[model samples]
Target: VRTVKPELVFEIGFEGINKSSRHKSGIALRFPRILRWRHDKKKEEADTLENLKLLLDPSNLSPDK
Candidate 1:
């Protein structure tokens, strides 16, 4: 196995996001896949962990808006 530094950032698509104790981020993504390679973006420009956590909000998951 080759170990590579965290340099590349990609946009990921997922069916759902949920809180999970099994993950370090305390969040889990269902059916995740690489939507696109963000070549134009730098690693520093990646989405923040807080932003991802926002998806866990109950209001955001509500079927009725």
Candidate 2:
């Protein structure tokens, strides 16, 4: 999924998710599902620590606060 900035998400509503990591070594997804249209969400109200962790390796995910 391509990570989008908050400015545009509000214009279209939080309906996007993507990977922008230039980390060529990481395993790329063949398809990423947009779990929800998230019209009720703000940028910070979108996905959370758990949401992002699904796409990351344990070593690379947010291990600490």
Candidate 3:
């Protein structure tokens, strides 16, 4: 098993993203899994918030459960 740090990048698979009052980013991941470490890439090359938002299903953006 590989452990990821804040400065490292992980290929994660999650069910969805949700609004979160507790997180600084105001978004949370549902049933997230750390699939693997992106060893060939640098941390700076990791996905950004915009990248994540772009991948989100627009209709599912609402926080309502």
**Candidate 2 lDDT score relative to the true structure:** 0.43
RMSD of 2: 8.6
Candidate 3 per-residue C-alpha lDDT over 5-64 given as tens digits, one digit per residue, 9 for 90 to 100: 667778999987876566666577899999999999888889887777676566766664
Name the 10 consecutive residues with the lowest summed lDDT in model 1. 56-65
Steric clash pairs (candidate 1):
none
TM-score of model 2 (CA atoms): 0.33
Q: What TM-score against the true fold does each predicted structure earn?
A: 0.76, 0.33, 0.67
Query: Residue 2: error of model 2 in Å?
Result: 6.9
Candidate 1 local distance difference test against the native: 0.79
Which candidate order results from sorting by lDDT in descending order? 1, 3, 2
- The global Cα lDDT (0 to 1) of model 3 is 0.75
Error of 1 at 40 (Å): 0.4
lDDT of 1 by residue, 14-65 (tens): 9988777666766778899999999999999999879998878585453322
- Poorest 10 consecutive residues of model 2 by lDDT? 8-17
* Clash counts for the predictions, in order: 0, 5, 0
